[model samples]
Target: MLDAHAWVCCDARMIQATATIRCAACILFLNGCAAPATSHDESRTASSASSPDNLSAATAIAHTRPLFDVMTFSQWQVVGGDARFELHALANPQESAAELTLVGRGPIPRNGFLVSPRELGDFTLTVDVRIGSAENPRAEAMNSGIQIRSRRMNVGQGNAAQWTIGGLQIEIDPSSRAWSGGVYEECGRAWLASLAENEAASAAFVLGGWNRYEIECIGPRIRTKVNGVAAAQWFDATVAGVLAFQVHGGASCEVAFKTPMLIEHGIHEWRALADEVSGSSGERCAWQSTIASTTRGVRLEIEGAARVDLLADDGARLASLSTSPEPKISAENKAKPSIVELLWMEGEGAALLDGVRVAQFACVTVPSRVRVLGESCAVLRAESLQRK
Candidate 1:
């Protein structure tokens, strides 16, 4: 009996040890499995700033260097200068701010220009431009701009292909066009996005001061702002290219571009001119090629005096124009709605779209299976499972 009791106690001890070992091995396996998931989550968190849509609103400081330096001295080249402008270091790059100054008086001063990393389709450029108009009353203080999607023509003159070489010039003037940020087609075309009389309020600029200028471009839509007020907006999907700044012959302009930022989806924006336009009587913007999809479809957000028109694949008329400026359509599938839905909602608030006189806002998402013919189109899906 004593031997049996001892054997029973040993058996119980062995069973307990086995159970403990199994629990330890299970815990170790779970921890190892969880390690990979944790690493993946961290990686995704770090890459959150790399989205394409986020680039639309991206900006960089003129005098400061960002953590990521895409614009370096080596990346810049000059024309018509003989060491005229001195690269000053008044502001400490590491301490306060870094500024590159053009300090000289000559017939044709050296101009500053930056080459983009890659060719951009649509973008908005912003920079702080100041002129020394106070020093010389006749001095063309600053006449430069943030050039985009532009091909290098000659040393100083290139053809933008969209209009002139300087696709869009942020007028840096302290003389006649004071603070007016108007669009001037370089050597080829001459169309003023802003009239002198219309831009009076914005032209109330202070000479010899740092004023902010923002130029927005998406697909074909373009808008510009001066000192936070609306200047000009237009639509022109002509060229997808490079960027530069031009300091015209006698006009001494010193302009700096913050980081080149972009917004991918909603190309259309709003301008003050939108309030002065007209919309269709009962016309809705068409998005699809099929008559069935066009007629009984939703009306996206319309701005200003934009009239809607429906078109077939062959550019033929299809559905009647939706007079409704804002319309929402439900998709046939259970998936979420597309860019069209987002823009139809968000674009309504924009004051500018592309680079022309478009009453409709930009950046509408379309269904992958569908084709749009009008100014814009977008795809949408229901949030919950619902019968169409």
Candidate 2:
């Protein structure tokens, strides 16, 4: 009976030991399946969370450099009118950063501008602006704007001549007209785009508080938003110029601009691929191309017949198209300069002649080279290549 009892006790101990080993193995397997993320995985997860659109993705990954240092005014120069600018800590509870304040001294001369010396072509810009403060809500109905693709010009004659900034101005009207976010051609054609037709945009501006303005310029298209509402969009011939802040003349008002950020979509000049080789490369020698990773498009100014070829990295031609004048063009008009553009993604591509679509095709690869075969082509331009 004692031997039988001892054997039962030994059997129970063996079963307990086997159960312990199986439990340990299960825990090890579970740990291997649910491992912790590495730093690279964490970064990718963060990037994916923040990028909601192409612009956001570009802002997140490619262009992380600021346009200017907000703490100093060294990168900017004051042009026209009598106004003073000072960087001060914002008193608003919603914001903690310093704001650049522009105070029009008194009723003086022409329009005053705080201009940037650096010129930009295609870019996205955002700024927080306030025309008046709570201390002084009615500040002479201050009129102001963010100027882009602008230039300095000499107006009047002799001693009357004064250097004034003139170009595309995004209107900031706090008056009854409520033309805030409208596109105005300063010192040139006036009111290229107005909010008279857009009621939602006209009501976007806050009278005594801060308003956020977002502006984008790509190729010939210009778009604007006021306080998150679509304000204006216009296509123009203006390509590149300086940026400025305008304090409209005839109004002694105070304005504030804070957190001005810009992401530049750099312009790339085309290079002749055939010139890279030794002797003449036959018909391919006429080809001028830009090896860039462009998400936007390519622009070409062609005067005669031309062929554009999109090539892969292995010199495999992805797609090719012949350019011609638009259907509306007469025989005589064909001799004139025509604008041709190619916009493409991984799966689709389209060719535009004089802003009208001429051809569409399936594209399998993102072009490694964009070559153009033509004689007397005026311009070949593309967005700068962005690499992570």
Candidate 3:
């Protein structure tokens, strides 16, 4: 008795559950498939297998390299305000992890950042953060953030010389509002995504204590999680920039980053479709394909006058663009090959003709196919971004 929409939802949930069970079984099978261990290996394995925490420690020991070396801040630099950075050993004698602490001196004149020297494109970063310590108890009220796809620029000159760092920021707010994990545009368009309506995400931050943050960026899509709870999912045009840790330009703040890890997923590559189709004399040629919601864009090369339409799953037009000067293509007119691109993210879409935008539209739908209609037009090449 379930409706079409309800049935789809139920089917999706069932598939997810099945996939999770299969993944767990695969892990167990792989573990059992390992070669027989030596006496020393057996002893080590027995000790770690005794508890999940011990197993996690063993795994950590296997991969001890961090994204940056805290022992010497060679990969990082401080920009703007007078903030002090130091490496401190963890208080726990049993643990070998160290923390990089940033302490601001009194009130800062402008926002200061502990920024990465190199720029990153698509990547996954995880960090354990603590807002305040016994020595800086007032740091709980301070504002801070982790910046991705950001840049530093000199805004003034001479004695008035000042640097400004701006880009996408994963907020580390410690105020009563508790918007930790929200996405904000630092020195840009302001709040890009907020956790105000998401009670669980907003309440995930523990005041004056350590919390884990995981951020993933692939193409234009960005997602964040706070202590295992999904926080934000958004998209932006900025694809590459430096990563940074911010100390807002106001009150003194003390923030510690521990065991910062990173996994670089290089930029998404464009893959060409296998089939090519041509449309001529008012004939329409269509290519059926599913465009993932996370796809950054689609590219196609058209030779001669043509109109391309991005169609939704229901065959409805989501966005369209045409190279023809008139509504209908003239069979006598011939044109050279031109590259056309349809870029989309969620509700917004833009069409570019040879690297220049010619049309833009807003629609809340997933593109599923591409259709070309024209006279004497041929789609030479079609490409789509590979999913992460």
Q: Best lDDT goes to which candidate?
A: 3
lDDT of 3 by residue, 301-376 (tens): 8777777888888878888888754332347665457777887765776777765557777767777777777656
List residue ranges in candidate 2 displaced over 4 A. 1-61, 64-67, 70-72, 91-106, 134-136, 268-388
Clash pairs for candidate 2: none
lDDT of 2 by residue, 191-264 (tens): 87899999999999988788999998766567899999999976554556778887677756677776677677
Output the worst ten-in-a-row residue range by lDDT, candidate 3: 23-32
How do the residues 1-388 of candidate 1 rate in per-residue lDDT, one tens digit apiece? Answer: 0000000113213211111111111101110111122232332232222213223443433342321133332223232232133223233333211233323333443433333333445455555655554544444544555565554333323431111234455555566655457766554355646546556535655566666777766544467777787877554433255555554445544333332333422222221111112233344433332222211122233332232333334444322232223443548644322222111222321222222232444323321112222344332221110011
Clashing residue pairs, backbone N/CA/C < 3 A, model 3: none
Comparison by TM-score, 1 against 2, better one: 2
Model 1 whole-model lDDT (C-alpha atoms): 0.37
Could you tell which candidate, 1 or 3, scores higher by lDDT? Answer: 3
lDDT of each: 0.37, 0.59, 0.64
> What is the Cα root-mean-square deviation between model 2 and the actual structure?
23.2
TM-score of each: 0.46, 0.54, 0.58
Residue 218 lDDT, candidate 3, scale 0-100: 69
Comparing 1 with 2 on lDDT, the higher-scoring candidate is 2
